[model samples]
Target: MLSTAARQAHILAKSRVPAANFGLAARRFASSQVQNEASKEDKATAVPSPEDLAKASHLPHISNVEMPNKDINLKNKLEKPDYEKEGYQVPEWKKAFGETFVSLFHIDMDNVRAGTIGGSKYYYMCKDQGLQFTDEELSETAVFWYDTLGLPRTFAMWFQITTLHVWLLFVRMRAMPFKMGKNYQQKLVDKLFKDIEMRLSEEMNVLSGQIRDSYMKDFHSQMLGMIFSLDEAFAQKSDDVLAAAVWRNVFNGDKNIDIVKLEAVVRYIRMQLYVLDSISDRAFGFGDFEFVGPNETVDLLTAEDKAQLLKMTKMKFEPEDGKTLPSQKSKLSLDE
Candidate 1:
């Protein structure tokens, strides 16, 4: 009903109201979005309170600390050389030549006796495994030991193998609870090292007393290194880590090592560890222990054989009504 110009102006006014409202709504939306993003950023950057850190600190068996040189004893009287006085310094060239051609005069009788005792004990322990080695088996073991470790069938090889077996036993002993385990471990270690020292002194018989002392010191260091490395490998729970540890320590870092043989060794170690772990504490404490034969293949172990290996505990016999009865029944059937 209005004039054309008036109608156009009215239409424009109505459109302007919506456009203004839309712009204001957009602005409000953007402002809300900005606020939301800011809140998100604040949350992302939030730090835990001291109370939270304190609570975390109470977690059991969680530690990031490490000890240095705790295993090495510089002040041990056994480690000290009889010839080298405190603050005495020998020329490098003289020390080397002297060690190469020095005369051997006296042997430590005390160390010799201790070593004989320890070596005999270790031999008996291996013998108790009931492994009746045939001539062929003995030859094979000798070859394997020499080829893998670059050592001949000598006293050195004997000691090395003995030490390895002892170390495996030591690993199981570590799982034992309380000071009883610690005491046993200490005694074994002491005997093992004393035997090693005696062997170095008597069998190897280096010319220089200083050189013999040096070799003993070096061997002690190597043992410590092996222990720590094995501990780390076991802790990782990875086959790769364990294999590497075996290659390093047992193979003596030989680059041209046989992969198949190395794998066999790895399997052997794992199987042994599992068997050792399955043994009851009472049985282990009573000196009832055994090792698999060197020629035994873990791959060929049947389920029954595996079960038998796990059952290291001896059967308890009770006399009832003049008849001996077994206290606990074995899960393994005798037919196997």
Candidate 2:
């Protein structure tokens, strides 16, 4: 009923109210969306305080934690001496003369030095002792190694066997009194290493200095690993553990290793260790020890049988009614 201009103005006014309401509604929705996103971000990055973190179910209990002692003195207290400090000092003149004599003959000084204990009458006693395995014993063991483990009679095989025997002796040596045990162990280890070095150059013709050095480093690392494996196995006193160690280190982790042969080796080791354990310390140190013959069944031997075998194998140290024979001391003096 109004004029056209008034009618148009009224419609425009009504349209403005709806548009403003729509804008308000849109702003509210947008604000709600922004708030929801902010809440999510807050939840995602939330960091709890120390007290709250302690109360969290996923964390380990603080009281159950064990911390290592950081004190140097405490750490040092666990270390043991590797050798005797006393009774190893020689006269300067004698030491000089011995060194000269050793050098002149192209003798490996390391072996001599390791075996020497001040003025000990029996220098190179460890080398002279020479593993104490009889020819037959050696041959039989070699056959077993070759046949059972498929090891060829190469230097590598020799090294493994020699290391194995040395490890057995080392185990026995550890049972000795601390100073004596350490001295014997060091001497034997030194001799073994020096001999291996010599064989590499002489027999194996590994003449390159660099190559020899690299091989020696590898050998040292292998020795450490073997020692750790053996120690762990022996400590556990489990046949399965020992067999696994032997298979891994000695057999080079052969996938088709004969379980029976491996068991035989374990038994052999136990038997040898037993025999060595029964020997007198003096005999062991003086190089009078001998291994059981290869034909001898170590595992089958009863305690009485072992006692009798020990008696038979016992080395006679009597020098024909106390007659004074020329000792290593006399020989060294003669060389000088």
Candidate 3:
């Protein structure tokens, strides 16, 4: 048998135990990454490839990709977004359909109509950087470990949960006006917003067609059931399939879009499509959003319907019309 030194040498060949491969630490790191990647590739409701979509009438619909606690840091990529002009050889409606979807955040769509810095640049930056699902999510992660989880605002900071914890002092004891403070939470939100931009852009471009056809025009019955069933666990697939499709299209040289701009353009459109999807979803169902049906291109879920209808029973009420409202025992009441 090999002596202890020889055995140690064999294990070292795998890499230093203290450095690279450390049992469960390695597994957690590796498996978490695999989970993120695999989840992205295998859609709970997989969107068909463009080739498949062209040939099949009944392609599996786009399902939601759920969120996970931790994720992988995909390689950093830098690219712009893409959009079609009127004269492109592809069907106008197909292109139009692709372009028409909206986003969930209704910040100010009109503010960023084009794919410029003020518009979709944010998405491009995150997508290319491969930013994480969010900052809190990103810190443990990060595309390049350099970009937009951008260096912290301060070289020094702290997390204070309780006074006792503070006294234990993981952070510096000094509190001076001359130094930067710890705003990990806001920094986190800002970073998360960047990630959101990347995800939106990538998804918009990948599933642009679906966004226009199923989501923007209106939420269909299939989407409703699929989305209704999806918790955070299955939502990323929706983003992945869409993102994959966009990459496929962009790679094929189908549009005049700048390769660098693809991410930004996609991010911008994704944000827009998300809002439209939310509006459409809220139309037929309760809560902030809903999934009405399979992507059949319906318009039943309009903004008007959403604003007017509160309950599935078709109950309607003026803002302050409490007398006509359901009782305190009402299960669907938002007040509850």
Best by lDDT: 2
Question: Candidate 3's error at 30, in angstroms?
Answer: 41
- Report the lDDT tens digits of candidate 3 across residue range 1-336: 111211111111211111111122222332333343324434343332212222233222222233222234332322233432223375667745534443223223222221222123322322222223323443321211213112221101001011111111111111111121132122322433454344434533434655444432232332232223321212343444433444433222334423333333233223222222222111211212111111111112234533333232223312345453121111122211
- Clashing residue pairs in candidate 2, if any? none
lDDT, residue 300, candidate 1: 22
Give the per-residue Cα lDDT of candidate 2 at 253. Answer: 82
Which candidate order results from sorting by lDDT in descending order? 2, 1, 3
lDDT, candidate 3, at 94: 70
How does candidate 3 score on lDDT?
0.26
lDDT of each: 0.44, 0.46, 0.26
lDDT of 1 by residue, 1-336 (tens): 111211111111111111110112222322333343334554454332212222233222211112112112322422334332337686888766654443233333223322332233433453223211122133444433443323334443354455566667667656665454565566667766664565455435555778877877877777777777776766766667766877887655668765555565555565456445544544444343455434432122235633543332222212244442121211222111
Give stretches of model 3 more than 4 Å off: 1-287, 290-296, 302-336
Model 2 misses residue 333 by how many Å?
30
Please give the lDDT score for candidate 2.
0.46
lDDT of 2 by residue, 25-71 (tens): 22232234334333555445433221222223231111211212223
Error of 3 at 4 (Å): 74
True-structure RMSD, every candidate: 32.7, 36.3, 26.6
Query: Where in model 1 is the C-alpha error above 4 Å?
Result: 1-143, 147-160, 207-209, 298-336
Task: Name the regions of candidate 2 deviating beyond 4 angstroms.
Answer: 1-138, 299-336
